[model samples]
Target: MVQADACDGDADRMTIREAIREGLREEMQRDEYVMLYGQDERDGESFEVTAGLHDEFGDRRVRNTPISEAAQVGAAVGAAATGLRPVVELSFSDFIGVCFDQIMNQVGKTRYMFGGESEVPLVLRATEGGTLGAAAQHSGTVHTLVSHLPGIKVVAPATPAASKGLIKESVRSDDPVMFFENKAIYGERGEVRTGDRTVPLGEASVERAGDDVTVVATQRLFGEAMAVADDLAGTAELEVIDPRSLYPLDAETILDSVAKTGRLVVADESPMSYGFHAEVMARVIEDGFFSLDAPPQRVGVADTPVPFAPDLEAEVLPSAPDVERAVHRVL
Candidate 1:
């Protein structure tokens, strides 16, 4: 679902990792107050997503932090409150629980509690979702958890272009943003707009246009839905929508699509019960109830932990076939 002409002639083909690094570099150059710090960030660690960043920005702006989630996030909150824009990398979204108190209480409530006098312009970056066989502990899509909190903005970019634009937008925002990068799509290549182009935080991307059904997906599932739409092309026209920003979700685009197709299939990697799919389904039913031609279907992981075993994990995780079936059910 990578856009062929994302920025017209002002675009380049880059992996999601490179696009993110480029975005970070641009932001750092654009604003002197913007800084990035986290575990092994100076060395770029295993993924090397921030490999050249430390070399360019040096130790002051890209220093490594101790292995403490609470401290990393708490420090980010403090840094943001004092006028610096800090982007803290948490390594894995699964480890967010260790610092949930800091995120839920401090990062989420500082502005409101201070009567809008204080601004925590922080960005919490983490790699999330499965498909690498990293097992349950390292591969959980927990954006839904952060989205439940009141003040934080949740973003899950599906393509390299989005990865670049959303990161820049998240860094510049005057509010705390939880930016979740799907671990599986870092190497995926796409055309990324150059210059100061930034995708707004609350807008959705219509990856594919169709007439029969609308498939709303997030993160990795967005690509999966696109593939299904391609395979089922001509047989069933499927409209694919990627809700790039999960919170401040572009529900209007989704409602409009549902109104056109009269069918919905929300596909996400999170658990099904009380998860993102449920939230989207609830919104559709609440606001676009009469537009439904059939009961909306949700495709997601089973109500359980992501299994360590490859086979069990495959069984629990929703796949392209699951999305296709859901689309067919509504059709």
Candidate 2:
């Protein structure tokens, strides 16, 4: 007779944001060189993610910087080059513009420019999208912009488990990683594995396996696609894939999945123009052209600024219904 494996879990479920914080805390504890800093409003408060980190890690490790995005990012780059793994938060992804010069011109290009002599091992963490109605100024998904640039890795984790794993990996990586987290999904709960679980960069995770159609989604859109997939299961067996890390996309997995399903639909929270969805769709056509049954479909935010109004904003963004409709269209 064999004893069944029984596992002890966290007494209370934690949100995706909480899981990320836990990963950060664990990593910081393991690595003395790891530190965190960010421009958070409400007196060093952003989205409650860093609420207690400063207290636990002390002022030196969790120092709150000025409003200068470029300067702050530049400092992180310098710090990383000198051996510090600084995790800098931009507060909102939309504000990345302020630090775009440093991000694109300095940190991202350092490793390549220096011939790998210097490594900018930094993590830029931000809460993106408009679920809380922060308006156009605050809510935007600029991962596509950063992903297009070389030397930088972009990742958007859709679940608590992935969030924890991806955050830990990003903090430990030698490359500069742009970690985008949705503000809306911060409080969303899911199970996260503990004790050295690592999700590698540029890998896609199959959220739901199927054979009729393939739905590639990221972030919140992934959850929507899953729901839509469940609803469409009786009619069309739907296979849902979430490219957890966007920059170094797992094209093999996506291509293989599309080959099996013969159809592809990308659900993204970002705009359609030059977004990750566009990139994935283009890749599918280039490599999986013969495998595709029809043209690839994308369900995403319209190529326009997010509206201030709640209804209009909702209408512009992708949803479960939109995914379901796209699936039907592809089928």
Candidate 3:
């Protein structure tokens, strides 16, 4: 289920940040080759995603880097190319722009460029989405751009369990996985598997099973979809799906759901113009056209820069009302 836990951050519930920390600790313990680096990751990032990791792994593995996104990412690429598996956190998803060349030209093309000679078993962790008032420069749902590029795998988990499972998978992946954590929904918590729970990189989880409409969302929007579905349960039985992995998207699962419901509404936190929402809509139209009863609806961020104010941020970002409207349109 998308809202797997009854409520977020319960007594036993683990926050997404805590789940991620557990994933890192377990991965680091299982494989000494797995090391973590990035700005303030050891001491704790601004989001506290890596807090206390330094003490557990020490300065050797959880080293800090300079404020050079390009240099640090490039160094990680080089390190992974050799033998070690390094995970680099970009801190903010917006910073990926600074290391675009290193990621796209080098990290994405390394194995293919070498004719399948070597693998880039590295993971890039970054905070995504707005609602933190981080301003336009710091906040964004930029995983859409990274997923468009080939060779790099992408995973965006919504709940604590989903985050924990996918993160462990990303750390052990054979290819470079872009793990986008939604900054807006980091504090929410849910049940996490006790040990060795690894969600495969390219799998989609069905949050709710309904026959009326299919609502596919990622990250923060995924939670919105699930909540909206439960609220609208009296009218439309919504089948909400979470595309945990964006690059190697679980297209078959999504297509099958659309076929069953005969209606699809894609929710993407990114802007709508040529955004990731369009990509999922395209897949349904191309692969499940015959099954669709009505034109698909898309819920996405407005085609404008994210506003820094809380009110404006809510206006620009996808919300429960948007998902409900899309579901209504399809119905």
Best by TM-score: 1
Residue 22 Cα positional deviation in candidate 3, in Å, after optimal superposition = 0.2
Q: Candidate 1 lDDT, tens digit per residue, 1-331?
A: 2222335767799999999999999999999999987999998855788888999999899979999999999999999999999999899899999999999999999999999999999999999888778888998999999999999999999999889999999999999999999888899898987789898999998888889999998888888999999999989999899889999998999999999999999999998988999999999999999999999999998878888889888898888999999988987
Which residue pairs in candidate 3 have backbone atoms (N, alpha carbon, C) closer than 3 angstroms, thus clashing? 2-207
Point out the worst 10-residue segment of candidate 1 by lDDT: 1-10
Best by lDDT: 1
Q: Lowest-scoring 10 consecutive residues by lDDT in candidate 2?
A: 1-10
lDDT by residue (tens digit), candidate 2, 1-331: 0111222664336799788889898899999999887775224457878677777878789887899888889999999999999999888888889889999999889999999999999999888987677789788988899999999999998988888889999999999999999988888887775687778888888878889999988888888888988887788988888889998988889999998999999988988887888899899999989998888898888888988899988888778999998988888
- Candidates' C-alpha lDDT: 0.91, 0.86, 0.88
Candidate 2 lDDT at 252 equals 88
Tell me the tens digit of each residue's lDDT in model 3 across 46-79.
7888889899889999989999999888999989
Candidate 1 clash pair list: none
The Cα error of candidate 1 at residue 253, in Å, is 0.4
Rank order (by TM-score, best first): 1, 3, 2
Model 3 lDDT on a 0 to 1 scale: 0.88
Candidate closer to the true structure by lDDT (higher is better), 1 or 2: 1
